[model samples]
Target: MPEKEITRISKFLSLVLRHQPEKINITLDENGWTDVATLIQQVNKSGSRLSFEILDFVVANNNKKRFAFNPDKTKIRAHQGHSVEIKLGYPPQTPPAVLYHGTSEKNLASILAEGIQKRNRHQVHLSPDKSTALTVGQRHGKPVILQVDAAAMHAAGLVFYLSENQVWLTGLVHAEFLHVLTT
Candidate 1:
């Protein structure tokens, strides 16, 4: 498939798989997985041409590795960033001493005042390093990276999980645990 087609399909998949499987009348399993064949059928039924090969291409070529296939290639799901309720089932693990979150400078004040909230998503997403966080921030404009004190939070009885794409997940990061990272 062409690059534009790939991106279009990727975005569509993200929309359906992560937020609204009901849009295509498909259902995700308890752990957020859905049948791959059923997904292709529904996607095509919705007037988007999709095939297992194209799906594989999008999964393999997406820069963030947004989706994954089960070991048997029979199931698939977004790694995280779900709006509708579905458990990802990633086990809790100790994060690095620090993790990074990037956002527009415009949002910094609110973030610093309230810490980071999950908002519409399931969990606050954190990056393992500044560069990735920066890229994420740039999307929102006037990028600003915030350093999170993961160690302190963990010590304070908070839990963290690393998604398949290496994005960090946490229920919350209180304002006290954040520091504006100066580049």
Candidate 2:
């Protein structure tokens, strides 16, 4: 897939799944899920266009096994509240391993500009060496070290494992990680 396409899908996963809706100050249904129409509207409001079909395609075609269908396929939600949904797909096998979450207190723009720029994976493993990680921690007014179990994610139907790798970076991770690592 094109790099830009990957980046776009990654960002959607982070915003809709990993980040807390309350942080964004949006209310969710009692089921903790949002409707596909509302989700599309939110993306458009955010200056992005993410159709349900795109989400469906991503969830369906992702090689990494990051997304799944809700009980009815009429809606989509993260497998786990803590785990970001990277793509749109239902996997045959559950994922095994743990995922790490990096929280930031910074506003969404800064977080995006610095944290999620050019990532290939669905989730990210955070470290102190990265400025985005530190910024996320600083913004939150606290240090963040998140350890998430992929198998648990799989069981909850939030995250599907792509490979056997134990750790993953959020697909929505800031592009700076790529820029910094590439440089």
Candidate 1: how large is its RMSD?
A: 1.0
Task: Summarize candidate 2's per-residue lDDT along 7-99 as a digit string, tens digits.
Answer: 578556646654655433444454445666666666667677677777777766654434556667666555432433334232444433543
Any residue pairs clashing in model 1, and if so which?
A: none
Candidate 2, residue 61: how far the Cα is off, in Å: 2.4
Q: Any runs in candidate 1 off by more than 4 Å, and if so which?
A: none
Instruction: Give me the overall lDDT of model 2.
Output: 0.48
Clashes of each: 0, 27
Cα lDDT over the full model 1: 0.94
State every prediction's TM-score relative to the real structure: 0.97, 0.40
The 10-residue segment with the lowest total lDDT in model 2: 174-183
TM-score of 1: 0.97
TM-score between candidate 2 and the true structure: 0.40
